[model samples]
Target: MTFEMLFVFGLLAVTIALFISDRLRMDLVALMVVAVLAVSGIISPTQAVSGFGDPVIIMIAALFVVGEALFRTGVAATAGNWLLRVGDGSETRLLLFLLPVVALLSAFMSSTGAVALLIPVVLSMARKSGLQASRLLMPLAFAALIGGMLTLIGTPPNIIVSGQLRAAGFEAFGFFDFTAIGAVILFLGVLYLVFIARFLLPQSAIRETGNPHPTLSVFTERYPTAKQLHKLIIQPGSPLNGQTLSEAAVRSQYELTVFAVQRQGQFLSTLQPVLSQTRMQALDTLILYGRDEDVHNFCQALQLRRLGFPETEMMKLQQRFGLAEILLPPDSPLTNHTLKEGRFRENYNLSVIGVRRQGLALDTRFIDTRLAAGDTLLLAGAWEYIRALESKRELVVLETPAELQEIPVHAGKAHMALSIMLAMLMSMTLGWLPNLSAILLAALAMILTGCVTLSEAYRSLNATSLVLIAGMLPLALAMESSGALSFVVDYLIREYGNLSPILLCAGLFLMTSVLSQFISNTATTVLVAPVALMTAQTLGLNPEPFMMSVAIAASTAFATPIASPVNTLVLAPGNYRFADFAKVGIPLQILALAVTLALVPWLFPF
Candidate 1:
């Protein structure tokens, strides 16, 4: 091997080791790879940061926002509610409806985002159906992986593989090219999970085993001082107009706590001590919690314009307002910050009325209390805004309030959101524009139509995933630049070129599947795809089946918690150990292998 080749191999080893260690953040690890490569001179400084500029990276980032818009507007949850209606309280029945719906959604959007939207819904289902979350999450995750194979834009791997084919001078695969085989695998996957796999899945101690907490009602009952919820808009003439919340002594003097404050059409919260300095201004909306009499007296004494909350408003909280319980994830940025410092309400457009730790409501008066992993928060806001919370890495929505009935977050925007998404998909499938342009237009439409806000569109981007893909891209370049990729391809063809095409395809499937379990699967596809194309050219065989195998194998990230972001998203909330994934995922891997070996050649033979 050349010295450059050796250096790249050593870098890969260290990167894999750090990823497995789980000590440092994955994005930091990716940056470490980018730095070492740039310093080593294997690739130029420009190449080191090239992944950031890659269309694949940008497309992935834009898709995150689009998927978040769907969730925020309640488009995703509408699918979950379909499952609940058909489930009828049976784990088998729920899985029957759940896996397919999740898979279909994954076919269009980011699978990780799909799982994030469904996690809370599934948890609520677990509570209602007396099933463990462990029973549901793995199936949800695996189905999403399979779903990625359903469309050209479903996951990064599909896009990378198509890009690779084009780079190799072949017509890129069609948008639904993957569907024929993907549909069968999806059906088989659902059957396996529903009938067999759910039994094998773990029942972690973290999951509420017996009766689950009454999610939203508990929040309402536990907030000691907030028996009644009221809204008041501060006008310019109000006596407290010039004073900060603390100086105004609204809580002590009025016996009411400001749950949330909205200013200039943007909602703000006083969770941070810094917010105590947020002076009362005219036209600020205050959501106050207290006894009816105390709130009435306070409003009268202060001459604040008390806005009567319509009974209809409270009745349709999901449509007008939303309630949900969120759990902080391990090693999250929000873990150590108090609500005030974190500006939870300001960032999320939600109100924090209660916090639960160790199954008991802590003192809500301590707005500065530091959040911890597994800390439960009861938040209320516009259902659309509450839906946006799922996109936040720091907070995992655990359960939708049963009281809200999972109200659609977008009132008029659902049709618009769905229409924009379909148009984006049609454009890609029909070749009206390049995938990147189509995605940019769709994402921009999501914002222009009020499906999501500017900050939200940006927040929707998963920086870690984007960075990881970008950092790893240079390694793919290095593989070809240093002759490492060609070396491996030559060796494989020399050994297996004469084998039946199916066996060769099977070998490719195993290798790609295993590699994806340890690294970013998109990166795996970027690396393997060129080699697959090269091998096909050398063997004088059709490349489609071989390329399809790589695409499918790249997505078999089921066997490890660290395998895919989707799995990582579920690991914490499911309270899973690494072995839990292995025990279930390994078997599914075998099944997927069998399916690929049986089907790929049949669909696209040499």
Candidate 2:
């Protein structure tokens, strides 16, 4: 090999090592690769950063926003809930329902985005169905991978292979050419997972699911507001100002219970619980729980100055505002940051009234407490502001109280989101618009029509996926530029030319599948598809079967979590180990190989 080719191979080796080590974020590793490639003078600076503006990268980013819109607008969850209902709380039943539905959705969008949308859904389903999360999460991810095989836009590898064919003067793949084989694999794959492979997965320690009556209900029960709660500020001149709770005897004298107390301050210590011996200082705001008449009677008895409005006015805020419950999903950006740090109120105009964690209410320090996935928040805000959160992929609004549903911020909006998604899909399938144009328009529509916000559209993207794609792209360029790709392809053809056409195809499938298990399927396809086509031409055989073999092999990225973004998304939520993926995924990879080998020759004769 030439010096440039050797240098490219050495760089590829180190990059894969870093990816496998998991010591750094994939995006950072990718940036390091880009920096090295640039400094080496292997490619122009423009080419080094060009993956940022690549049409495929843009398409992937737009697809994430579209998926988030579907999720926030409740379109995807509606489908997920339907599948859960159909599963009827049985593991076998849920698997049967979940895999096909996940696959079907993946067929239309990015498989990684599909997995992200369903991570919460599957967790919720596991809770409702009483199945182990580990049992369901792997199936969800694998099904999304299978879904990628069902359509042109399902995964990057499919698109790359089709582009290779078109670039070589052949027609690109049809939208449905992959469906027949994919459908079979999906059907059989679900059965394999539920019946055979589940034994290989270990049950993790996470509280995957439980009763829906969260910690807020406990607070509502203890405080027992008699249809009235007032934000009352104690005045300095009042009779109640200098008295402790025991001495004041507010409950005995005025029939009021102070459930919480807050004083204006600069730190997290200001908000605290009501202790009987604690004396109230001037301007201390107490949330009093009592009957409407009792509250009025107490106000008349004591010199408590009412701050903004009475309880009745609080009800009026409900006409414009509402209260709802939400749970943080895994991978929430809101986690690790307190509401103050997140600018929770300023961004959304919502107020967090209380938070629930593990069946305990946290009224005090609600804003200062850092959040975590699966923690619940009881929030109040204007209906529009609350509805706006519906598009935030990080938070899953569990239920909107029927009382809040009186105002109609949600009216006809779900249908609009669905219609927009359908239009985008039809445009791509029918070749009415370029995939990039259709996706960009769909993302703008999501923003213009209020499905998601401009800020959220930016948030929906995974920087790791984008940067990884951008960084790895140069490797492909380097290989091609240095004549390394041709060298490898020629070497393979020379060594294997004596073998029969079918054996050569199988060898291509094996090489591609093994590489994909370690690297990106899209990158693997980019490198392998050209070689497969060239080998077919040299053998005087039809290129379709060989090219199809390459495509199929590239997607058999099941044997490792690092193989696909879809797989990595489930890593923490499922509490899976490295061996967990290999134990189950390796068998599926072999099965896929057998299926591809048995099916490709018959489907398109050589």
Residue-level lDDT tens digits of model 1 in 92-128:
9998888888899788766865676577568656654
Instruction: Give the CA lDDT, 0 to 100, for residue 435 in model 2.
Output: 68
lDDT of 2 by residue, 1-606 (tens): 889889888998887777657677666877887888887777787777776787767776777787677656656555655666677678888888788888897898667656876775676556545567888898889989988888877777788878888988888888788877777777778888889887887766564354433332343543233234567888778788878765776755665556556675622222354554567878887765556676677777777766655433443333344466788887887888887577665565565655778866654434457898788876654566667878987789886654443342333467888898788878865778976788789888988999877786787676766776667666677767888766876787789877887888889988888777655677778778888888778778888888888877877788877677677667666867656788899888888878887888898778
* Model 1 ranges off by over 4 Å: 89-91, 105-138, 148-180, 199-202, 205-214, 219-412, 498-501, 516-548, 560-583, 600-606
C-alpha lDDT of candidate 2 relative to the true structure: 0.72
Q: What TM-score against the true fold does each predicted structure earn? A: 0.61, 0.63
Q: lDDT of each structure? A: 0.74, 0.72
Candidate 1 whole-model C-alpha lDDT, 0 to 1: 0.74
The residue-level lDDT of candidate 1 at 528 comes to 77
